[model samples]
Target: MQQQRLPLALFLSLFGFACAGTARADAGSARLPDWRVSGFGTIGVAHAGEREADYTSSVMKANGTGATRSWSTDVDSRLGVQLDTTLARRWSAVLQVVSEQGLDNSYRPRIVWANVKYQATPELALRAGRIALPVFLIADYRKVGYAYPWLRPPVEGYNVMPVTSSDGVDATWRWSAGPVRNASQVFYGHSAVPLVDSLHLYARHGVGASNTSDWGALSVRVNVLRADITSNIGQDLFDAFDAFGPAGQALTARYAMDHKRMTLVNVGASYDPGTWFVMAEANRAISHSFLGATRSGYVSAGWRWNTLTPYVTWARVQAVGATLDPGLPTAALPPALAPMATALNAGLNSLLMRIPQQTSFAAGLRWDLRTNMALKVQVDRVTPHDGSTGTFINPTPRFVSERTSHVASVALDFVY
Candidate 1:
């Protein structure tokens, strides 16, 4: 629909200001640029019980069971490297790259972040370039398996929005008062992601804000974001729809994804005292087009005993209607075209079912093998909503009934 592009002038202005300000602020400091390199990875194996469909982590992946007919390492395996350099006392830069299974089934390296940061003061900072989209509580570290207690974030909520990185600028403010720390961030950016079957998503204009509060072992966070979305319905399909003339045009106007706005809201709370922890997050994603709306959340609890921690989690996602009318206006059309209209309506209904609606239960254990490495084993039982396939992709024809999938995974996560 609507394509929004970031202007090169905006990036140039931000970059120039940071470099000039840093040079002036650090004129007296003799410290040279400091560089640090670190890496993180996960080696994992996964199997899904469903034989008719592939249970995937996100829309970007084509891994899992079904036609693969074998355990998939691509489901939970990735390697990432990060480099951070201090250009001056008040300015720094970070670049992070990750290699993982991608939409094309290749282990291509993707630039997740490459941003220059300027510390305006002790409590205020500004950054511009490619930055991670903080759409959820753990958005910054979602790829770093070692950062979270679970082997992976619950797909029910995390998989709703697949765009990972945004090209734009953001400002963060941090302060502390009476043992309580608070941080607020505001960002504006644009991103694009490719999905299954030649589906491409373009997010042009986006703006969001998040607030986090930390009080000892207790923490809370809330975030809200809105973005304009544009996606292609495939060239062949478009041609066919166009052939139907005015009726097809009307259908496209109602269903084609172009220039629709999507909104996301998330809230989370966690309590951790080293020995035991409980965390919960809730999210709602809505789009004005056929992407429809979904509500999802997860609750997890874990207790640590020395180097070993066991956790249990429950998660669920549900569809909240596609905002489509149940009755089609086929009666107003010519009798000869009525049948075609009915068929088109049926296809539209089938497309709307793509929205995920499922529930999952998981139990896992994390063993800290070393200071920066951990071993994890997790199992999940997922039940798709009646007659719905949930997040699984490439469903076998006629296998449209409700079904359950059991997944087992083991991973070694390391960070340095």
Candidate 2:
């Protein structure tokens, strides 16, 4: 793994973020009721209209029915808990925990966020420790709204670069820009991402920054991020496609390539004018997309008619194979693959190209039953652009998929 650490000196200077004003002060500050706790959870079920359409996590493959139908159910359901306690006159501590279907069906607990702070002032925060990245303006609260008309955020764009947290120091500065409140962030840090068997990400170095503008119920944000890949991150996936051969030289041109840098720049906007709302996000990555240079965008609109809200959303994503070593499998099969390679190629050809592309048309409904709870239902038509007529090529019948599947998802969300 590639290893790089900033001098402990920067740590000394960044620790103990000092804020300007004290959230807890006077009798209110020292009151015994100084601590507050809240929690939220979701229980939901969804069915894909395809027998071979499996659920979204790795766990579904191992534990679920593992069938062409009713395969797995881990999508919109999640749980979270947060606690805030005042530490001193103007300092405090916050901790949050979340459990959800993540990274391949491994139900893991992510600290989500745990930090100590000195509120030197409300307008500015000098926070250190492990801080969450402020990628999208709503990225922080993307999960809290079962009240959201959509069963989930548009995945075509949001799913491209979904990183949870970073280990580093961050500065959150909030001020006013005319009628809007503005928040900006700058962060430098080391991210410890689990290997998950990918050779390239066995370890990684992450750096990113974002800016947000909030005017009334509308907010807009843009972010830029770059990651330096120093090790063999995800060679196995290539191996799956027969990219690597007995000769390791097939992997990289340089004995060691310079840190592979992945950069992302995204712009997102959302507006809620009471009874009406509109949201759109567009992101384009350069030399760092899933296949590199992937382009994705989503647009959604909703209207509240009393307690019920109806919405529609559209999204598209495309990734072409450009960065990979063309000499590998898709380009030429190694001798070891021989007959199996021939069979694999034949089967893959029958299934069409695997260049990643997705277009979705979704319709959703939301009902607010109470002040703290809401019910949401969404149905989406997801079309995979690989041109494979159906899921699971006849050869790999085990890998079943529906060429087109209607996904119906429903969930209950609440915070108390």
Candidate 3:
């Protein structure tokens, strides 16, 4: 069993008592105490049509359950709070906190960001404390779903890398050239997570940099980040799949996964002309390899008009050797269980050999039902790059058998 630890006591102790007393005494300090507090929420349910594939966690499947379900409807439903404070001349601070079903329904108030800033000059600023790496232009506003025209950011692309956040210090630089506005950031930090064996997650800590440019109708951002991920369990992901089946193995060798540091490169661009908006991004991640290092990427485009925007997305998830254990029974099983065993074995083999490449075709629509509130509907048809996505298409005892998951939802989001 994996045990998750929350380092909240430290944060709680400092959340209020540590506000710099001197900042309150400055000339315009009274204005600083005006707390602009806001609440944002999303109440949604998704239906996952996995056609009976067992799903242990929604985080891995589509929506929240991913695609390992026979039938599921809700993805990730969450809520959050934010505080924006202007602490005297050219200085400001922010804190955004959230609670969500993470790492197996372990709901905890994760401090998304807690930082202070001082604008030394209009174009330069210094900041310290925990901060989220603004890998994407929308990364900072991810919690504000109303700002986006999608029922959900395309999971096939947006979630390839966990939202990279860390305990560290960083700086920002903003400037403009002719019709282009530019901003750049550099940061360094240390990050870590808890739990291992049977269940675990690798949290890495390192330094990174990002830059963005806006030129009239064109906007672009490029980010480069490197971190020494701890790996799912400090074991070769492939070997772990084989030896770490649910039954648990004898537990052979275990070693930390390091790059020295894993590096990720991403580039994004968007074009808008009032009535239409088109956007896309491409990313590549490379790290050490026992089976051999791996690379993955995706491309997507969307269009918007008024409050109703419809999109067509096609994406492929490629893994050279990322397959884990298929949870299959050994061969030579009784006749009654042979069919089940065979299915498991095949799924396990493909996963182990990296034989499965997944392709998806999806269409979605988002409607701004009201100010700060919206409703969305989408449908996706998924096909395995090889074989039934590594498992037998079985009828889920608890849910109806469906080849595709149809999802629709209404949500209210506000920032005040």
Best by TM-score: 1
As a whole number from 0 to 100, the lDDT of residue 35 in candidate 2 is 77
Between prediction 1 and prediction 3, which has the larger lDDT? 1
Q: What is candidate 3's TM-score against the reference?
A: 0.74
Q: Candidate 2 lDDT, tens digit per residue, 115-156?
A: 655556877676565567666545676656553567777767
Each model's TM-score?
Answer: 0.90, 0.77, 0.74
In candidate 1, what are the lDDT values of residues 97-160, reduced to their tens digit?
8888887788877777878898889999998888888777788898999999999899898988
Higher-scoring candidate on TM-score, 1 or 2: 1
Candidate 1: which stretches are off by over 4 Å? 1-30, 195-199, 234-250, 323-343
Task: Tell me, by lDDT, which candidate is best.
Answer: 1
Query: Model 3 over residues 166-263: C-alpha lDDT tens digits?
Result: 76678889998888999999988766543323544444567789889988888898988887765443244335434435432311221225334567
Cα lDDT of candidate 3 equals 0.56
Per-candidate Cα lDDT values, in order, are 0.82, 0.60, 0.56
**Model 1, residue 303: what's the lDDT?**
99
Candidate 1 vs 2: which has more lDDT = 1
Q: How much lDDT does candidate 1 score?
A: 0.82
